[model samples]
Target: MLKNIVLLSILMLSSCSTDRKVSDKVSIMLDVPVSPIKTYFKEHFDFESFIAIETTDSFLVSDIKKIVRSDDNILLLSGNRSVFLIDAHSGKLKVCIDKCGNGPGESKRIIDIAFNEELGQILLYNDFYKLLVFDLKGDFLSEVKVGEMYENVTCRRGEVLFYNKLNGYSCYPYMLKIYNLKNKTWRTVGDDIKIDFPIRSRGLQMVNSKRVWFNAPLDYKLYCFEDDTPAAHYRLDISMAKLSDDLIKKSISDPQTFFNEVSMGKIVYSLNSLRETENFLIFHSNQT
Candidate 1:
């Protein structure tokens, strides 16, 4: 019930829109007015049933890298070294899969995670192109070998989509690739893209059990995959032309400076994550 309340509250706040422009196109356009954080938080603040995770002997969390909510449980990945499946309501530790070795279901460290709610399984991954599958209870199921090292991954229809976020520095040319488990085949989704994002993020945003949205740290338009192709989902009400070609080129060649410039408001800040309600979508931008 607490998880439900938190979720409801987040969705409720995410529906805020001080201003908007309606559209009848296939891709809906939402214009949200940027308001001050102090006013916004003061207006929507709630002190009921907030969640706080405690550090334990078995689990010492420097940062929660990823999180997925299912039923009354939460699957969390911490610092890409520990994975925990805990009770969402009581905050009790259910299972901590921290097996780091060279065994069959072991890795040097867990780098990423993807939840297939439809399949009811968890995929623990590493940067070396490996997958450690586990059930909801954290039992090791099997190990899978992927062709490329993926920075972000999400599953759909028994297929796992991989985004190679190497920023064109790697040997691989394509940015997005899909691997079908049933057929044991591989296919590229889009053209070669090499821009690297500065902020720490979850590359793909899962919307319900059907849609997934994607955008880089500086990308102008958020994209959704349709028929394995990325289609424009929303226009961020920001001008893409304000971003010069030199900056785009630097995003790949030199990411640190690009991150610095973007942080100092050298250009239009980019949106990172999205939360949706019935009518409006809320985004957390980098600087604003």
Candidate 2:
């Protein structure tokens, strides 16, 4: 019970460096969808056409994790190992960045990838190993050595923001951090983070225009990295579906038992990814 309280304590209604705190009163109870996902999206979202990427044998993209769009091209991160640049209009593969090594312009392991609008380059993090930059044509540009282990990556112009998650295998403490490409200086947010998230490994950070929005797992507060600092944007109160530490430990060792309990109508909080639009706030929860 005590361990549960200390876990994810960095996101426990503390005021941020921005000195802005969202009211906890603004909570939401999500309703389980009775309808299928296709039906739900069709009814709720506006169709703005579809994109079909041409599959080819040359670029065998497997385990594609993330896709970020530019004005003309889209950058795809696959297996967190390689990056593929594709034409957004033609859906053709433009270039592929998959050089593996410890030498110049190479990555030992890509922790995450994001586009840098300021330099018109791609920032590939080698999991606290190195920061490799490349042009859209897959040409190697430069590298910056970094020592922080961050999972999710997003950038705006000159600032690269990261959502740091200290999992059972990691010891880096900050929940969020910002790296300046010019001077290579750093500013951390939620350095008090010391949570040992066992079930979840990856953290999430979604870029919307100029603001970067993210959420802490099993928690309700929505955070945004705006003005170079972390601010609590929204507090999604699903206090009713409270998470249990005993259940978490049990689920780690015996998932079947946990699923069985949930099948028997056990209410547990297991929300992970978060995304916000101009009008709607979207999230994924385990209850449904």
Candidate 3:
């Protein structure tokens, strides 16, 4: 069963405004149809047999929390503060990191994990507020202290991008905390705008191998960083439903009531998740 899965509709916008001076605002009107929920199951999915990984004393898995694929290895994070590297094809355990202590090369809590294929390294973010580095063979190399706590972390081009919220008026300028692995320093990116409410911001997203994209949770504008500065990309407009400032403020105060109202079709909720590709921008709405 797919839990908390959102069905998204992809929309491709025509024409690209590349002129540095041209306004980067594109309005799109969507006429979404309201339909009832339905379920369907097919019997034959290539008639494949399932191969289960046996749980033994050496390969004990207790509640697999997250799985990340890197080449031929499958990295599984467990709820018991352990990380296991398994072979993707043979379903065999390669190495497991289960050291849960304050000693060196150990972590009390694993917040997140990312793999760098180019460097052949595994980056682990832990509750100690540090980023631990290990090779593909599960050997600890080094660890770096991070400045702030982040909910999401991603690495690209030798730089680690951390996404988290800042305390202050919503008008603060930037939210991204970028740490340079080579220079051993940190910096911020994105534009300063009114943050009317305290909400989770979707931080840096990798557009390609080098570029990263960003967008505010409350705003309809999409931005991409060009040399560490945010440049306007596109804007979305919904014709069937509109969100007003009053509704947004209410959502900040009482999210449960706001979601209840959105479920009842009283207001069109804000865009939850936004994703983009070379040609199209995809997103889902709260309206069923």
Candidate 4:
């Protein structure tokens, strides 16, 4: 009788284990619906109608490519190889830097521009791997030899922030570098992330005067730096519209196939250009 009881107990235990396994499998196979994420934009801000500013006779811009805002002036980069500093309010031409030759303070192609308030200088980057410094009055200050061609550049607190294309390939993880005008030294940052593909244009912006923000061309997250150190800050979440990892890999490897799939409305892609303000973070993406 005892032996019979022992066999019966073993059978009961096995039956219970089988039931638990079946229950777990059912739970794993259950379908759950995810809630959609909601985004809100501020609508309390006031809006003003546009008023066109007439171009003065002194300020002759052939084709304005880009404009940067200074204290009370606007720096206009024209396609005709000219840089004009004009008053923002009066529409008067303050100064124009149009030195297009193979000599000093001359640039074949202007890549980017920055303003240094403390030194009262304007920094212009050229295609020939040169950083030309000029006074606010359009006088040539000095020229520094840059190692590689940079697509975008900005200056703040006497330091120039730019990404060196040569270093991006050689230095796998470090893509952004800072050049100090005080000591004339280069320091690398952005070491936490690694980019597999070569980025032609990097997104680097100075938020006010103290912090700097950057985002890779293909990345969804934005990074910020305060005094040369990464700060704990905000992150963007578009997982609701993000593509699968397999699809992202395929897109990078086989762009033609990815484009075809996107054209057929089979894939969803996220934003590339990211910008932020005190109240809002703006980006553009494609949805189907």
Candidate 5:
């Protein structure tokens, strides 16, 4: 009788543990959508009448600051020295400073900024194998290097994927690199992808809670990826102009509740002026 009782207790405990794990995962998922901001922007920010904002004139002082837009925010990389985080919706500059391993005479020399949102971190690749990571606010985290030589870095929400090329004129398949944030390690994935091209433009952006989007410069269009396959494509209309810098700044400040109170299926347009800019533009979207 005691043996049977113990067996029942073990089964109950196992079931309870599984239930707890599932409950915890569901709770976290409920707390935040898989790609809340990205989905909203994709749905709402159509090409017709969008505004742009200048996050920083770092280029004004020098040619160091380059703005790279992620799924939810814009990153200003000052060479490899410092980084600035801009709010995607409002264009407000949140934080700015140097990142990891402080250097007194830093020249701001980062080759690329890749955001692994799932890991809540950013990857900075300096040289072929030299890489560093930091929080969103220029805080030091960790650093590592991989392979022999690679010119660029590409990243998604959970992985920093890279590729390198061979020496000389022969453009052959070299190596494809993958780094895991959970394990904090690097490994080779496949050798079929050539290293002739830099890995800057290739990335996967999460669309909605259950969908993902992919952009390839070679294709020059945005594609929705479902179940690891191409699902939908959005072609640009040439008549629509890009957003002005002023509008981009505003959108960056508060993206979460920025475009609410509008229909989610049809395109809409709006006009707004910025704090210190003259020109005005319209923002059109199917999501608000």
Candidate 6:
């Protein structure tokens, strides 16, 4: 009778255990400050629409060479011999004709532009293998000959991350990059950091302080780099991809309203933006 009772108790416990649900929770911490970003815009030229190159001469002072949108302001590198500081909102030109460095190779190509948000300066690399550093006000700080790497090197999130290509290899290991401004010498992230994807990614982004996200070209995966090392990552599942597609479609459909919404709320920088170009590099911060 005692054996029978014991067997019955064991069966009951097993049934109870089978009825319980198992849930796995992943805790992801965000390091970037989730605060409202106050944007100030000063237009370099008068364009009918905002946040885009205006076709009209009134807005097109020169060619739209390059533009970088940061937390504080927009750095405009135009065809004219200078750069401009535009307010993030209102599109007003806070400072104009702020010349630091000339266009590369007779105005053919402008290499890479890096914004040092902490230092309140923008570093511009030209085709002539020269690096020009300028304050937000457009004041020239210094210019140095940077060699071949200057043309290919790209920065993500200011000076936190830097990337360039390897000689003679355009395929696997076609990329060489580094992180943190304190170090100038570039070191490849890790060995066997293979990204099996289609299109080549542009650059890396500091997703908060601890995590760095890089797009796998032609693939939907976001490669995570932790502590300047390759890490485990995942592709954007269909649902997340759909959500992102919707957001982008909304922006293209109605940029004004979308920009307003982005300005009014906390703007999480898009990982897609970093993938828009082929020369995009990688970056990370220390917060996380």
Clashes of 2: 0
Q: Write the per-residue lDDT of candidate 1 for residues 1-288, one digit (tens) a residue.
A: 222212221323221112112222366565655444567645654444454555565455557777677667777887867887767777767888887787877778776777766667888878667877888878888777874666667777777777644534442223457666557567665556454444444433333223556555555566666655666677766532266678767776788877787666645645555555455455565554
Tell me, by lDDT, which candidate is best: 2
Stretches of candidate 1 above 4 Å error? 1-49, 52-55, 165-175, 181-185, 194-210, 239-241, 250-260
lDDT of 4 by residue, 1-288 (tens): 111100000000000111010011111121212442343332422322222334545445666655566666667778837887766665566788988886999988887787776687888888778899988789998988886765567777888877535444322222456688777777665553444443233223223222455444344444455646534244454444445566556665886776676657633343333455555454444443
Stronger candidate by lDDT (1 vs 4): 1
Highest TM-score, which number?
2
Q: What is the C-alpha RMSD of each candidate to the true structure, in Å?
A: 8.0, 9.9, 7.9, 22.2, 20.2, 22.3
Q: Please give the distance, in angstroms, between residue 51's alpha carbon in candidate 6 and its true position after superposition.
A: 6.2
Give the residue spans of candidate 4 off by over 4 A. 1-64, 164-174, 192-194, 198-210, 239-241, 244-253, 260-275, 284-288
Error of 6 at 280 (Å): 21
Of candidate 5, the 10-residue stretch with the lowest lDDT total is 6-15
Residue 230 local lDDT, model 3: 57
For candidate 3, what is the lDDT? 0.58
TM-score of 3: 0.65
Q: How accurate is candidate 1 locally (lDDT)?
A: 0.61
Candidate 1's TM-score: 0.73
lDDT of 2 by residue, 1-288 (tens): 111101010111101133232233444444544443767555666644345666655566677677677677678888967888877666677888888877788766777788887778888888645678888778888887666566677777687776655446433323566678877777665545455444552334444443566665455666666655556666654534655778656666786776686657645445555655556566666655
For each candidate, what is the lDDT? 0.61, 0.62, 0.58, 0.56, 0.41, 0.42
Q: Which 10-residue span in candidate 3 carries the lowest summed lDDT?
A: 9-18
lDDT of 6 at 11: 9
lDDT of 1 at 191: 53
- Each model's total of backbone clashes: 0, 0, 2, 0, 36, 19
